[model samples]
Target: MTQEDKINWLKENEPILWANTFKIAKGELSDKQTMFCCCGKLATGLHEDNCRKFLQQVKNETAKRLQEYIK
Candidate 1:
């Protein structure tokens, strides 16, 4: 999927993931923080995913669309 597509997917399918990731990116949340996620596990973590897929998509962004998804 394209970067925008991946981001949109996260926004739609993984809201808590999206919000916390942005928080980490903006330094508003600790990278070490852990919270319950809708993924039905202990955490989606402070990051999006471990595959680096999302990171590869957003890391180079100079104007990263920090839009928090709400569904």
Candidate 2:
């Protein structure tokens, strides 16, 4: 799926995770802070399946922004 599709999926299915992930990606939240799952599981912010997917979307978005800067 496209980055936008991924984000929409997260927003619709996992609103809290989406919000936290976006804030953290945008540097609005400290990178050192831990992200917790709805079930209270500790998310590594990388390897956890949903977080990983979200992060890939974040990475893609960042790359796109950087490309804009280079243009």
TM-score of every model? Answer: 0.38, 0.38
Expressed as tens digits, the lDDT of each residue in 24-68 for candidate 1 is 563432243356332334445444554254444343231254433
**What is the lDDT of every predicted structure here?**
0.48, 0.51
* Per-residue lDDT of candidate 2, residues 22-68 (tens digit): 56564522243367642346755444445554455565554444332
Clash totals for all candidate models:
0, 0
Highest lDDT model number: 2
